[model samples]
Target: MSKPAAVAQAAAPAAPAFDVARVRADFPILSRQIHGKPLVYLDSAASSQRPLPVLRAVEHYETALHANVHRGVHSLSQWATEAYEHAREIVRRFLNARSTREIVFVRGTTEAINLVANSWGRDRLSAGDEILITHLEHHANIVPWQMVCAATGARLRAAPVRPNGELDLEAFRALLHPRTRLVAVAHVSNALGTILPVQEIVRLAHARGVPVLLDGAQAIAHEAVDVQALDCDFYAFSGHKVYAPTGIGVLYGRESLLDAMPPWQGGGDMILSVGIDSSTYNELPWKFEAGTPNISGAVGLGAALEYVEALGRRAIGAHEHSLLEVATERLAALPRLRLVGTAPAKAAVISFTIDGVHPHDIGTILDSEGVAIRTGHHCAMPIMELYGLAATARASFACYNSLEDIDRLLEGLRKVRELFA
Candidate 1:
């Protein structure tokens, strides 16, 4: 309920040489005490806390240059519009998008995927075609494609994962055929933290002339996402996952693909000309964004991206990786504890189950100890079913997380075991 840093401040560059300790200071929530002790946040996969720079960027835009973008003739409108459009270029650079026109802002990853599936899928898919997704998919990626498949009388099939929670590339290879119109998969698993073999998947899909939509909701913050290098037709991510506001997200698509797909919705900003009988659609980016857009959110997200870029990608990745290694070793040392999703390459997520306790109970006990972690299916239930489990206790990390946070989670686990005993 407590929003961090309500006061507006100027954006700060990540200290010249950037120290992890120094970076953590930007997050006020991280410094607060919880349960009479320091709070240990381990749920970045759910949503990350906004850094001071990102918060200030949003505040500055709202206070100094507040106006609707691309519609007004006043000076404030020009300033606001430039700032809004600048956010797109920022995202384009952040994601290594081929062009700024490829970046489409929406509510979040969920809406981004929905927009593509409904707009592109509806226009391109036919009854005999099929969409190939993996069991590792979150509901956002899985559901939208399913809706498209159902509407078009197309079929949906899941590429299975091995028991270790890694996608079976061999199985995924077999699923690729002429009818496989699209391959939708997560760049990183939300529950398992599996950094998927996306490039290989993309190469395979591209060989078959099939497009790929990558759900980068988890990967954007932790790993380097290069749409040009990955050659994915679409990449979607949420701002909240990257220390930005809840309602902002990005959909990066190839210029040709975007131009080919019709507008998802018809409204003020998404059209060229409107008439009683018919309406003409706008170009690439704008065609996807209808109505008054989340211009403030875009600025905040760009700031979040800038903050991360300044932090140095390698440093953040190394810091979180070290924390995950510590958490993994500590949790694995516990008797009767089973670690789920042991993919060789993983992000900061650590999902494990104690011998007899339910994941829900574990989550409750952890929260009581002021150590936050996600429990239950983690929105990938089919993946759970594949592993012969209903759910897992997940402790996901972010740049703000420290080694002590992992210890708190371990302490919380011990408490849960003690109470049940």
Candidate 2:
């Protein structure tokens, strides 16, 4: 994604007017002080602070609807099953997926990718087959395929990212060959904040008859994702990144593809019937969702999606973009400070480094100031190596973040520079 030329020419547009103070009030943690200073949370890309609605939803489910699903005839069991399935429906609507059957709830993005790699890649890919991916992928996307390749005798190939942190489309096109079995890449670069051109990537891969999977952990909250619109075969995202509980995430697969793939795991819910000789698997999603699922986490995720919809995704994006613009200008003006990712278009993440200051030191000093930011490789070590950096201090934004948060971050960075100098 590239910044619009209009924004570069004129004053960056003001974020659409909203009652941000009221929004802030919904998150109780935001009100607390850290180190005797108001917490300036800018690490949302790592995990967003859950609001009242999500917290309440989880509480309600635990208190009132606590029973094993799809097992018993009791009222509590029936009610719990309804709540659990209803959460699946919410996930289906959230992604604009064609059917609820397409949504598979897992522990998080990492588990979801591993599920695909084990269930789909391991069975289908053979010797000499290639699994195409991008250099911008998170470790969750990378290691799973590597594991599958080693098991299946398939090769793993990565497309290059340009110096500006954008994917090299031509290189990606060239990499898609006759032996390519799958194309898995990040919807947005987790470390660099570069929103990858997923639509184009999908188009190119589809033209070559290869299915595409997107690691959408970073894009789910910041971008409007319609699986039907994107036409990707699979999309994976973590609930925590989108203001939900930590243990829940989603894998949205095309119903046809999911139906064809074997169950990733075998356990209680995933079986239609179990015999000593052979076991029958359940239908589409439940097959992949073996054992006891994260029932409360799914409830919280549904509530979080509802909360985000009520706030309006477009409005939240605009506000974050405004914050990004302001932070970029301020950080650029500071001497000896270098921005790592400068893609033309980006989400609200900013990765930067100051001369003579280690990123860990930057994070520690920011913590002392009650300003939270992520430091180190951020689970994308390949990206760190790409830019010739060991690590970078990353400040990421979310709906609850305000311009004042950026101010505090800058103040902390200045202190870090002075201390180092």
Candidate 3:
């Protein structure tokens, strides 16, 4: 079940893209049963199951080469450090970032955002300066800005979206002014499936001389992200969401921007020389990393990324699109069912509310039926309020999921409807 990690390190095999039958073989847990029914993991938007290669890589490191990275002058440190840095290269390639130096590993997306807000936002923001974000942001994107505003006397404005869950570009344009310092937004919404026009948004933001930080937690895995192409100043995502381990994520920042931001935390490896009065910092990414980084986690992340790269993003996306289309059609056919996000384009996420059923109630029933899905505002409350609901049930698909999983989800929905009726 492990990814051909050694093979992945070498040239990729000439494999057909979008081979779901073969792709399913990599994820070991996809074969399990729950509640007398086969497990159908339709929640990759929250977290993806690890492939055999990724699992094996993690085990290989822990068993043979487990050690603290970046400090020891020993052979184990060199091995672990190489693994960790190689993992960064894998991530850099995954995002098409310019350099591995631009990829700073943090615990996950939340820490990545805080690094920017506290380190960059705090230093740059001033009283009456405006920070723009969208209604579709996850709470991680929202709360950090709120703190920045409170600390610096800057103002936070939410760019409104339409009822169809599309961003109101006009509303966003109107909010932009001379004082706008930073524009933070989600590349793809977690609760709703709307894919924001981040490239266009970035273009606009850059035109105004404002830098944009994209909350790429949901978007990075579902779509091919090119930080250089999108020209987003910063793009952040969690490895756990991309079939890697928890406590590992990346912050892909523009080299110049990263060079300017100070370290949010003052600790071990982040510093060069410390004196009674002052201290100097390390270069580029290490300055921000600050502590003994997640070596094994990073190695696992690299392996997961290798699996993804070998699988081919274009084919993976096409397969996901088919699954999403089928699920959307099936769910939309139900009476009393209202989809929360109906953008012209979306990732593998589908959010909806059934009349007279709280999303949590629906989720509970589905879980009992051995179906897993997400419920609640999905940590993006402003858009939930905009839709006039407290929460929605979200069924997300990953590469390993089959059409049969969607059918099971539909069956569970019908049963819920019957109970209500």
Candidate 4:
């Protein structure tokens, strides 16, 4: 599809009969009151609220099967190991990966990226090599590469972002030079909600024998990610962004690449044997997943993915796009409120600023009216620098949100205007 067409399709709404009320009923927290008013949560991009199924799954694991995995032959240990490994299989299926060996569990997206940088980048990157990225990247994507580059005498280069928040495709293509060792980028910008052209990026990078890593923290919750179809070397995402518990995430690496990379951490379960003179590491993913794994968190993540699957990702995307469109049109019509990151193809995140009001003030005022939104640079300081912005107030949506929630947001923003005026 043409870029514009793709953008339009991304912004397009799904079926109108998406029973959002029914979906809202699944989440227990949506009914709570904040400051004597109904809570209007618009901060899913930071961390999504967990659904009942995810909570129940974690509770069940903790109550019935709490034990360390992969070592003990006891029943609880075996059960916990089964649950943990089963979660790995679910993640493998979610990403359409070849096997569970390609799925490595970590604390979250940050640790996953660090694993690749330390294990893969440090091993292969030499002096004068280049690591190419985009200005649309979150700090998690940029800092790891910068650290690796600084250590290896490699240079870090970032492609420019258009004023509309879209990545500069031509500049990105040009930046993929012969010495470009890796291409790391956000699948969707958390700050701008820009949906990057990752397929083309992967193709371009692979054409020049460079591997690509997609930070899927923002994209995974809203879309169906088939790593094989994208053909990217590495895909990382955090669980908290997807209605799962925090401190749990997955790294889907191509088996060949993962096999060649050394262990990123050393501890129990990651080692096959230990000797005073020399030690041997475990195979495939276990080599990278050192220490005791987050068993209950993995269970919760599996349940969360199952919940998303049951609701249908496409349906959720359409519902969110509708919210985005309505919010954009309404916010744009208001005086002195300017929308930032008006990318054509975007996830359901809206970042904006008022002419005279600081984003923190906006957030604080909105909070008084029981509306919760993120206000800050959103950990994308480079993107903020690119736009000459200190911060923007961001309202991000998820499946449980509804048109009523958007109305609440508008009402809260009006209160902000009234207070400022």
> What are the per-residue Cα lDDT tens digits for candidate 3 across 319-378?
799889989998999999998899987999999999899989898888878898999888
Candidate 2 CA-lDDT value: 0.91
Q: Residue 405's C-alpha lDDT in candidate 2?
A: 90
- Displacement of the residue 88 alpha carbon in candidate 4, Å: 0.6
lDDT of 1 at 382: 86
* Alpha-carbon shift of residue 254 in model 2 (angstroms): 0.5
- Residues forming the 10-long window of minimal summed lDDT in candidate 3: 3-12
Q: Spell out the clash pairs found in candidate 2.
A: 1-345, 2-345, 3-344
TM-score of each: 0.95, 0.96, 0.95, 0.96
- Clash count, one per candidate: 0, 3, 4, 1
Error of 4 at 126 (Å): 1.5
Alpha-carbon lDDT, every model: 0.88, 0.91, 0.88, 0.91
Clashing pairs in 3: 1-52, 2-52, 2-53, 3-53
Off by over 4 Å in 3: 1-17
What residue runs in model 2 are displaced by over 4 Å at the alpha carbon?
Answer: 1-16
Candidate 1 Cα outliers beyond 4 Å, as residue runs: 1-18
lDDT of candidate 1 vs native? 0.88
